[model samples]
Target: MSLGRYVGRRLAITVPVLVGVTALTFSFVHLLPGDAVDAIVGFRDVSAETEAAIRAEYHLDQPVWDQYLLWLRDAITLEFGESPVTGRDVSATIGRRLPATLALGGAAWLLALAIGIPAGIVTAVSAGKPADEVGRLAALAGIATPNFWLGLILLFVFSVRLGWFRVLPPDAPLVSLATVKFLVLPTITLGTAAAALVMRLLRSSMRRELDAPYVTAARARGLPERTVILKHVLRNAFLPVVTVAGLQLAFLVDGAVVVEGIFSWPGMGRLLVRSILRRDYPVIQAIVLVIGIAIVLANLLVDIIYAILDPRIRY
Candidate 1:
């Protein structure tokens, strides 16, 4: 199928999935054991009348189906209601916070690409050499390390001991120099594991591609080693890498919860944790919906990239 038709098909599939996700998110969040009023106000501090008023004000007294429909309708029109805990508009809060997450995710993704792709290539080319062994070991270590623990260690060594970075400064504007100083440890924390995964996948993919008949043909045709690998081998090898990177982006967005909390970064992950703790159903639902959509779109983009990279793919 044509690219346009392929994209349309993907998006059509995504809509219902998102709707299902929204419904499930709404239900599960509400299912969490707690009174929303008590979540906002300390238990035993509020009168019955005040508690009833809070429930009525937020329409929490409505049936689950009605609440889901109401939220879905508002969300379709980009009206995500106010946060029950903070009394701020959900849209405005997410709008203010999403950029930080995006910036952090983007930085980590770029770092992973910068470190991973080359490492994979070198490891593949070197095979059983010392460089390969060291790269493989490092990747193993990175994959095994917990992001929160890594964040803390980096914070202590870089931010505390060396005084090279800050330990979660007040929410600075994203994409600025000030934010760069704050992002260093968090980026490393988030990217390290992802990079390791990507590196291993890439190395395996490249090795398989190199053994293919076409690679031998290219080499026999007098192509330089660099040309054979870069112009021919890497292209085919990179298809799986592209898919992994896309999924990694999704993982990074969701996994940012731990790193964001550890660093106290003002992002959707941090907001998500806070909303869950405070039983802010609206915020929780909105964040989950957003994240679900993001993952779907990221996968869609990867499909498109696949089509572009290899002409064999079609709808």
Candidate 2:
């Protein structure tokens, strides 16, 4: 199929999936024990009338289906309503926090690519050698390590003992040097697993490509080893890596809650954790919807990239 038609088809499939996600998120969030009003008021006791008024105001007295319909309607127009906990607009809150998450995720993604691709290439080229063995071992360790534990270790060594970085992220603008300094440890902590995953996948891909008949054909044509690998093999090997990277990018965007909390980063992940704790329904629903959108779009982008990288791929 044509590129435009392919994208349209994917988007068509995505809309219903996102709607289902929203419905499920709304239902599941409401199903959690404890009322949002009680969470909002904390330990303080309020009058019965006041509690009723609060519930009426937020339509908490409505049926689950009613609330979901109301939310879905508002969401269509990009209106996410106010946070029950903070009384702030959900969209505004997300807007403020999203940049931080993007910065963190983007830096981590770049770091992963910088490390993973080259390491994968090296490991593949030197397969069965000590370097390959060491790379595999390190990748295994990276995959096994927990992000929160790694963040704490990095924070303790770099920020506590060495004083090279700060425990808490800075209040500086996202583009500033101070922000970049603060992001280093978090980036490394977040990116390590993704890098390891990419490395292993790419190494396997390249090894398979190396054994393909085309690699021998190129070599027989008097092409340099570097040319044969880079020009012919790596392109084919990179297709799976592209898919993994795209999915990882989506995961990084929404799944950095633990890392963000550990480092006190003011990102969407941190906001999500807070919203969940406080029973901020609107915020939680909005965040989940955003995550769903990200995942769908990331997959779409990956499909497009696949078609671009390997012309043999078709919709």
Candidate 3:
């Protein structure tokens, strides 16, 4: 089968999976115990007339299934309704906040690539040396430190005593891109574990590839050590690396919440978290659905990329 058909097949599977996710998310969020009006108003003395008006205003008196269909339809048209807390369009709120998350996620991805690949290569080459030990220790630290704890430590040390950066200076204007600077600490915190995982995966894969029959044959046939390692070993080794990286990106979406909150970086993770705390079903379901779709789409894209990278892969 061809790449096009393979991609189509992936999409065919992803669409229904996303629909199921959306439906489940909607149902469960609304199922959470409490009156939506009381949850929003925080008053025990809400009048029946006021409650009825609120229900009519948001069309909440409709059947749960009807409410879901209405919401799904509006979402398809990019409407997304208004936030109960802020009284702003949900889509608009997400639009305003998305760039902040992307900025952090992007920074984290670059940092992971920069630190991980070279460390993996060096560790693989150095096998049992001091460099390899250092690489192992770095990975250990990265793996052990939770993002929330790491962020707090960094904030305490760097922002508190050392005065390197402030604790997320009050929502700066979105135009200047200074938000990148604010998000740096959180990004590094978030990416540390990912970088470490990638390093280990690559290091192990590279070590195995270097010792494989083909590499041994190439070396026996007069290939330089450097050429054999770089040209032959690393290339084949990267197929697994690509898979790991794609999985890391998917994990990053949900995993970003702790870092997002610590840094006050506006993103879907933060939005979902806040919505859950407030029991805001619409916002929660919407964000969860978006995240689910994004992960499936990303995996599909990765598979397509794999085919493009090596045409030996067939549908």
Candidate 4:
């Protein structure tokens, strides 16, 4: 397919995926045993009229499919309804928290790329040497390190023992110089695993590309090592790297929940945890739908990047 046609096809595919996401989110939420209304009303004894009113208010009296349609309709317009726990609008709640998550995710992604790409290139260039072995060992450690544990260790070393950083800020400010400091540990926590994965992928891709006929021809023509690797090898090798980066960027949002919780950063992930704990169906559904849409869109974006990087790529 042509580039435009390929993009169009990808966008077309996204619609059903989003629909399926919404359907599944709604179904699974209702499937969970427990009354959200009961949680909302709390331990107070209530009359039957009040109970009926609460059900009607949330459209719980409607059929399952009907509730799904209502929720989905509001979600399409970005109106995700009120939170059962906080009585706040779900959309507003998400909007407030999303920027923090995005900022952290963006930082982690850039850090991963900055570290992973260079490490991968060096390992590929120095294959079978001590540098390669050391790189592989570090990557292995990074991949094996649990995010929460890494986060806690860093917290103890940096915040508790060294006094280099604060564990939690007294006042959470989204934009400030201190924000960078606030984000450092959490970013490292999330980025380490992603970086390892990217490094491994890039190293393999680079090694494979290095063995190609064009690379041998470039070397035979007396091209400088840097020129051969940068001008020829990296372009081809970057396709899979870009693919991994895009998918990981999507995952970073969800992954932020753990890091955010460990570090006490206010983000969508924390909100998600709270919503789930409270059985706030509307909030949970909205958060999940947003995440699902983000993943689908990220895949589409990767496809676009693929087409740009290699003109031969098609839908």
Per-candidate Cα RMSD to the true structure, in Å, reads: 2.9, 2.9, 3.1, 2.3
Colliding residue pairs in candidate 4: none
Query: Model 4: per-residue lDDT, tens digit, 292-315?
Result: 888888988998999988999884
* Best of the two (3, 4) by lDDT: 4
Each candidate's TM vs. the true structure? 0.87, 0.87, 0.84, 0.90
Candidate 1, which segments miss by more than 4 Å at Cα? 29-67
Estimate the lDDT of model 4: 0.87
Superposed model 2: Cα runs more than 4 Å off: 29-69
Error of 1 at 51 (Å): 8.7
Candidate 3, clashing residue pairs?
none
- Give Cα-based local distance difference scores for all models: 0.85, 0.87, 0.79, 0.87
Compared with the true structure, the alpha-carbon lDDT of candidate 1 equals 0.85
Candidate with more favorable, higher TM-score: 1 or 3: 1
lDDT of 3 at 305: 78
Q: Where is the poorest 10-residue window by lDDT in model 4?
A: 169-178
Once model 4 is optimally superposed onto the true structure by TM-score, how far is the C-alpha of residue 28 displaced, in angstroms? 2.4
Cα lDDT of model 3 by residue, 266-291, tens digit: 77687877877876656766677667
Per-residue CA lDDT of model 2 for 192-222, tens digit only, reads 9989999999999999999999999999999
